[model samples]
Target chain A: MLLGAWGIALFLAGWEVVGQTGALGMSCPPLSAVLAVLADPARALLFQRALGATLGAVATGYGLGLVFGVVAAAAGHLLPGMRGGLDRTSSVIHAIPSVALAPLLILSLGRQATPAALAGINTYFILYVATSSGLAGTSPVLRDLMSVLGAGRWMRFVRIDLPAALPTLVSGMRMAAPGALIGAIIGEWFGASRGVGVIILNAMQNFQIPLLWSMVLLTVMISLTLFWLLGAMQLGAARRYR
Target chain B: MPTAVRVAGVSKRFRLDGGADFLALDRVSVSIGAGEFVALLGPSGCGKSTLLRLVAALEEPSEGQVTVAGSAPGELARAHRLGVAFQDHALLPWLDVTANIGLPFRVAGRAVDRARVSALIGLVGLAGFEAAKPRQLSGGMRQRVAIARALVLRPDVLLLDEPFGALDAVTRRQMNIELQRIWSEQGTTTLLVTHDVREALFLADRIVVLSPRPGRVARELVVPFARPRDAAVMRTEAFHRLADELTDALGGGA
Candidate 1:
């Protein structure tokens, strides 16, 4: 833990130094300047609205994606006939970049729901892969034992396969957190009314370097916090289930 | 005695990764009488475990049939009349000893019989460690929990594939002694697969030795030692002679 803190500290310090030196460009404003912009009272409501909008989209997308992913994986497991088709369909969906799909999603889902749709799509693919593989990875010996013990399909799933797949599922959840955030932000770039992504794009176009950097910093902090929380859950699940 | 488990002219074949058929057992037949303790003894790769798996309904025979209590192996399993343990111990890592032992009842959609579970825990000498998880226990302790689990449902037939094969010699012998005592009390028809000569001589009512690669029965011996046999029985002259003969047969078969 101490080593990880040191690594983060070193990285932040390096970023500050590069920004202070103007090594990259005018857009690479000093970290202190970005913090000042973030701390400014006049801009607080704007930042709050943007953060809330983005977080709401992320939550909706992530929850739906996780539920669908687990359900689809379970269905694939219980009915072997659908597994190949599920795999192929999810792969084809994931093959198309989210950015390319953003315009089509905007047209159908409208600008208001587009961020969540994009986020859900990204989360769905990641969780589907993780859950399906994890379900298949149950120990053969345990499966045999369950069979000999007269475990029915539902009993075996609840008692053995689900618990065994938990570690992998938690890890996938952690990964999907950042992906979901990215999807929401990217969706906002295609002209959402209010979001961190919208403000960042506006700042970039209008040459508001410190505001742009502040929004980026805020987005990263939110993503890291969610990732770190899920990482802890993943560790607990791994220790318990394995 | 009525038969508890019967394998009549059963053969098992596996399709290897290279798409070639690997014969595991060739027309192997064995009948275990009700309440009898039988051991299928053979060396590694002799397919004795395959035979046990057949009885456990974990695999289907390429030819012939396996029956337990006058029904198919799958039928017996579906009726929740089967119990099994393996070299890997096959205990759920997340469940404590009591929950693991109570798994069969839950699987059968029956209420958890706390008394029966506790009794079996005591029978396996894991009484005080009922709350311990599988990973927290030593290997022998884990195997003891597994044995307790196999006995918890009063299963009509117990299938054990090298339950003690991974333990040290001393622990294995100790487990054998405990298993004999446990079996004497329960008298559930059992078929244990192992390569250990002394293990077979010590615990089995009868030993059937099988030869390797497309396994066929090479020898069968009815143990002469009287029960409730103790460790001292293993030191007896009769035990030694039987052990030696079985060891020689296993070595020759390999």
Candidate 2:
């Protein structure tokens, strides 16, 4: 943890130096300039609206995807016949680039719903793959014990496989958090009226370097915080379940 | 004595990953009477564990049949009348000792019998360690929890597959004595599979010695020691004589 903090400090120092020197060109701004734009009281409402919109999509999509993925994975585990089919379908969905899917989603679901749709799809694929493989990894010895104890299929699933899969599922949730945000941002670029992604698109096109940098920094902060929290949860699950 | 478990003319064959069939047990037969303790003793790879698995309904005999309480092994298991413990102990790492011992009741969809579970915990001398996880305990303690779990439901048949095989010699001997006491109290029919001749002689009412690979019963000896026998019985001249005789039988069959 100390090493990670040191690395982050070093990275921010390097970024500030590059911006101050203007070595990367006029587009790069100093870290102080970006922080100034973020702190300005004049832009608080704008930042709030954008942050709220994007977070709303992320929460909805991530929650729906998690529930769907877990249910699907459980179905595959309980019914061996459905496993091959679920695997193929998830792989096919994940194969198509989200960038390509965004325009199609906008036409069908409209601009307001597009960001959430993309995030849901991205989270679904990741969680489905993680949960299915995790469920498959139940210990052979434990399975034998459950059998000798006369556990039924549902009983074995509840008592053995679910707890066994917890660590991996938590890891999947960590990865999915950042992935959902990325999907929501990409969806916003197509035509959403307000979001961090909209600010980024306009700032880039208008050459508002500080605004662009500030939005990017905020996104990274959100993603990192979520990643760290879930990583802690994964550690706890491994300690208990493994 | 009424037979509680019967492996009649049983044969077991396993299909290896390379597609070749390996015979484990060949036409082996053994009968365990109700309330009797029997040990199937052999060298490593002699298929004694395979016979135990067959009776535990973990595997199907390629030929012949295994029955418990005059019904199929699977039937007894489904009825939640069979208990088992392996060398691995197979305790769930997430559960505490009390929960682990009470797992059979949960599996059988029956109410968790709190009084019975606490009684078995005391019976196995693990009264204070009820809330401890399996990882927090020593190897011997883990096996004690497993034995208590096996006896939790008052199973009609208890199958022990090298339950102490992984323990040190001293711990193994201590466990044998403890097991003898518990078995005497429960009087549950039991079949133990082990490679240790001394363990078989010390714990079993009768010993069935099996040959090395492609296992078949080579000899049977009835233990003459009285009930509630202690560690002192193991030091008797008769015990050593029987152990040596069985050791020779194992060697000769190999």
Candidate 3:
């Protein structure tokens, strides 16, 4: 753990050095200047609003995606007739890259809704695959025991499969955290009213180096924070379930 | 008296990857009377567990039939009147002892009878460990918890497929004694499948030995020991003689 912390610290120091020495172009600003811009009260308000809008999209998309993914997987699992079809359909949907998905989503759902829509779509595939495999991953011995005990389909799902699948499902959620954030930011670039993505794009065009760096750093921090939280949850579930 | 379970000329054939049917059991039959304990003894790959699975409705006979309580095995199971424990304890890792035992009630869509769950926990000698998970318990304790879970619903029939098979010899012997006492108290009609000669001899009222390779019953003997038998019986000359006799019968006369 200490080694990892040292690694990250050293990387940050390298970034600071590269910026301060103007080793890169003028677009590269020192870490201190970015912090200074973020600390300014007026700029802080804009950052706060951008962060809030992006977080709202991420949270909404994540929650809906999680529910839909789990439900779809369960449906396929309990009804074996649907398993092959559902699997094929989900795979085909996932094959379409999210980059290509942005325009279609914007055309259909409009600018503000596209961000959440894309986030949900990105989160869905990860969680669906995780939950499906997790359901199948429970012990055959346990399945036989339940059958002998005369458990109905729903009972087996609720009492056994769901709890057993929790660790894997939480792991998928952790992985989806960053993917969902990226989806939201990319969707924002296609003409959302206000967000960190829009600010970053505008700052880059205007050569506002410190503000652009601050926006990217903020985006990275949010993704890292959500990832860390979900990672901890996944660990807890693993300890409890396994 | 009505028979508790009937395996009427049951046969099981597994389909290999090449689509050829490999016969596991052939024209095997057994009967257990109401409130009786019968052990299906056989060598490994003798399909003894398959026979029990047929009775538990976990498998369909490739030919022939299994009936429990004058109806199909699935009937009794669907009515929430069947209980089973496997070689592995097969306890849900998330649930504590009390909750595991009460799982049957919940699965059966009945209220969780707290008193019955507690009583079974105590009966299994796991009273203090009511809140302990399966992983926290020893092998014997986990088996006991599995047995407790099996009996929680007070099913019409109980199926045990080597319930103590995973334990060490000493722990297995000790668990047999506990099981004997527990069975004497409840008298749940049981079909126990195992490879241990002494285990079948000690716990079963009657022992049916099966031959391997297209499994069939080789021989059967009604145990002459009386009720509530103590471990002292195992030390007797008769117990030794019978154990030796059954062991020899199972030595594959091929």
Candidate 4:
């Protein structure tokens, strides 16, 4: 935890130093200017709204990814051929950039919720692959143990397979959570009236260095909170396994 | 006594590369009576474990059939009549020792009898360690938990495949004693496959010896020693004679 705080401190220091030095072509505001903009009531309301939109998108996408991934993975076991096919398809989907797919999603679903939903769709494949692989990795001996003991399909899944695969699932969620945030931000960047991504894009276009930095800081704080929540879940799941 | 399990011309063959077949067990036949403790003893690669798996109905026999309690082994297993403990304890690492012991009950959709679970825990000498996970327990303790799990359902037929092969010598001896006590109390028909000749002779009423490759029973020795036997019996002349006899029969230096 201390190391993580130190890393964030170092990052902010570097950004402040670079901005104050005027290394870039335009005027680059320091940390104080970013703090001043954050303190302003009008800018603070904008920050709140944009941050809310981005976080909402991320949450929606991540939740859907988790549900779909588990269902697909469970279905995969019953149909071996389907498992292979779905695995290949998910890999293909993962290879496509979320930024690249954003425009297409907007074209089809048109603005509200769809772009966010698209971002959520982007997170699904990673979760699915992680969960399916973890479930498949259950040892043959363990499977036989359940079988010989008269554990039917559902019982084996709930008692044995699910618990065994939880650590891997948690790890996948950690990976997917960050990806979900990135996807939502990227989706908003393409076309959104309000969001942290839109604010950053507008600030860049208008050369408002202080507002851009403040938005960037707010995005970082939100991401950190989401990641911390995932970490807590991981630690809780790990304790059970231990 | 009624035949608890019958293997009539049971044969198992695996398909090899280039469409060839590798015969593990060739038309092997054996009959075990109810409440009998039998051991299938053989050297490594003698299909002893394979035969045990067949009896447990984990795998279907390519030819012939296996019956447990007058029904198909697979059917009986599906009906919750078969219990198995592999060489590896095969306990779910995620579950606590008590939950591991109560697995059969949980699988059968029955509320775990906490009293019975505690008694089995005591029976296997793991009374206070109920909350421990499999990884935290020693190798012997894991096997004891496995034994408790097998007997949890009060199974009619228990199939064990070298259940203590992973343990050290001292732990193996202790487990053998514990196994005898459990078997006596439970009165479940047990088929144990082990490389340890002394273990087979110590626990089993009859020991069926098998030869290497294309496994078949070469000899069946009826143990003459009385029940309630202990490790002290291993020092007896009769026990040594049986051990030496089995060793010689397996082509090992005696």
Fraction of true A-B contacts recovered by candidate 2:
0.84
TM-score of chain B of each: 0.98, 0.98, 0.98, 0.97
In candidate 4, how many Å is residue A149 off?
1.7
Better of 2 and 3 by lDDT: 2
Candidate 2 residue B125 C-alpha distance from true site, Å: 0.6
Write down the lDDT that model 4 would get. Answer: 0.85
Task: List candidate 1 segments past 4 Å from native.
Answer: A1-11
TM-scores for candidates 1 onward, in order: 0.97, 0.98, 0.98, 0.94
lDDT of 4 by residue, A58-156 (tens): 888788888988788878865677988888877887787776777777888776665477657766887788888788778889889878877778777
Task: Rank the candidate models, highest TM-score first.
Answer: 2, 3, 1, 4
Q: List the residue pairs that clash in candidate 3.
A: none
lDDT ranking, high to low: 2, 1, 3, 4
> DockQ numbers for every candidate?
0.83, 0.87, 0.89, 0.70
Q: List the residue pairs that clash in candidate 1.
A: none
lDDT of each: 0.92, 0.92, 0.91, 0.85
Strongest candidate by lDDT: 2
Chain A TM-scores of each predicted structure, in the order given, are 0.96, 0.96, 0.97, 0.90
On the 0 to 100 scale, the lDDT of residue A63 in model 1 is: 92
* lDDT (Cα, tens digit) per residue for candidate 1, span B1-254: 98889999999999999999999999999999998999999999999999998998889999999988988899888988888989999999999999999999988999999999999999999878989999999999999999999888888999899999999999998899999899989999999999999998888999999999879998899998888888998889888888888888988854
Give the number of the best model, judged by TM-score: 2
How many clashing pairs per prediction, in order? 0, 0, 0, 1
TM-score of predicted structure 3: 0.98
- After the best TM-score superposition of candidate 1, give how far the Cα of residue A10 lies from its true spot, in angstroms: 4.4
Residue pairs with clashing backbones, model 4: A61-A120
- Model 2 chain B worst lDDT window (10 residues): B245-254
Superposed model 3: Cα runs more than 4 Å off: B252-254
